[model samples]
Target: MSITPDKAQRIAALAKLAISPDQAIRLAAQMDDILGYMDTLNSLDTSGVEPMYTPVEHVSVLRPDVMRQDISRADLLRNAPETNGESFVVPRII
Candidate 1:
């Protein structure tokens, strides 16, 4: 899997990236190495291995939802610096 500078430039353009000619050349070589490694991995034998949905074991630690009494509006508004007996007052915006 040889990646040319032209191919690297095109890939960068598709990804909305700007790279110099020297950078493109460097990126092409790096991409080629990565693809070569992928090819090497593809040659492995895994006939007896079980298919995995995820790489790590996942456990849901969600706590049980418990209903509780709601606080009164007066109690909530008590800490407000400025209020109109219902809601907090702030400088008006345009």
Candidate 2:
């Protein structure tokens, strides 16, 4: 798999990237090398191998969900510039 500077420029444009002519040539060669490596990896036989759900096997440490009233709602809403008895007031939009 060989990549040309023209192909590199097209790839850069599609990715919304700005690259110089020299940079395009360099990137094209790098892309060709990567594709060649991918082709090598694809040739490996792994029909019996099971797919991984995650890289590492570990149980998640979760915290218990408990409701705690740290402060009153009236105290929190007191700082608002314009707030109704129940909630903060905002401009109506259609």
Candidate 3:
């Protein structure tokens, strides 16, 4: 799982990133260290441990969905400085 300079250069190219030769070498070393740490973690034993999805033990409480009266379009448009017949008018992006 070691990352070499050539592999790092290839990864940078594939990701469309511009990196110097010195940066490529440094990135490769860092990636190798990360992989080494992951490998070390993989060596740990967790045979009977229960997997935890969250730190706290509590059920999620959610309100039941119910329809409510909505505001009229004219009421909503009254506060806007600029708006179309059905929606707010915004500046063109492109």
Candidate 4:
């Protein structure tokens, strides 16, 4: 399919693009070249080729979930700007 100036103008308008008349003519020719290349690619036959989903093989490494150390609440609350008896306090948002 070939792209004409009128078609290019309509495409630019639909895409909310502000292009000059000269730019529209150039864009039409560029679009035609792109469609021509796509047509050439469509002519290639790949009947037995396997489709690749990812470029490389991937494996998930699993690890056991276990706690190694314990932290005191006093140590955590020491850096807070304001804190209640057991938790940090902050300004309330509605």
> What is the per-residue lDDT of model 4 for residues 8-65, given as tens digits with 9 covering 90 to 100?
9999899999788899899999999988888986778989989897876768666889
Give the TM-scores of the predictions, in the order they appear: 0.48, 0.48, 0.44, 0.45
Q: Rank the candidates by lDDT, best first.
A: 1, 2, 3, 4
lDDT of 3 by residue, 11-77 (tens): 9999999889999999999999988888886788988999987887677777889877598889989
Task: Summarize candidate 2's per-residue lDDT along 1-94 as a digit string, tens digits.
Answer: 5889999999899999999999999999999999988898688898999989787677877788988999899998999999987799999977
For candidate 3, what is the lDDT?
0.89
- In angstroms, the error of model 4 at 45 is 5.2
Local distance difference test, per candidate? 0.91, 0.90, 0.89, 0.87
Candidate 2: residue 93 Cα off by (Å): 21
The local distance difference test score of model 1 is: 0.91
Superposing all C-alpha atoms, what RMSD in Å does each candidate have to the true structure?
Answer: 10.5, 9.2, 7.9, 11.6
Residues 27-83 of candidate 1 have per-residue lDDT tens digits of 999999999888986788989999998876768677879977599889989999999
Give me the candidate number with maximum lDDT.
Answer: 1
Reference-based TM-score, model 3: 0.44
Give the Cα RMSD of candidate 1.
10.5
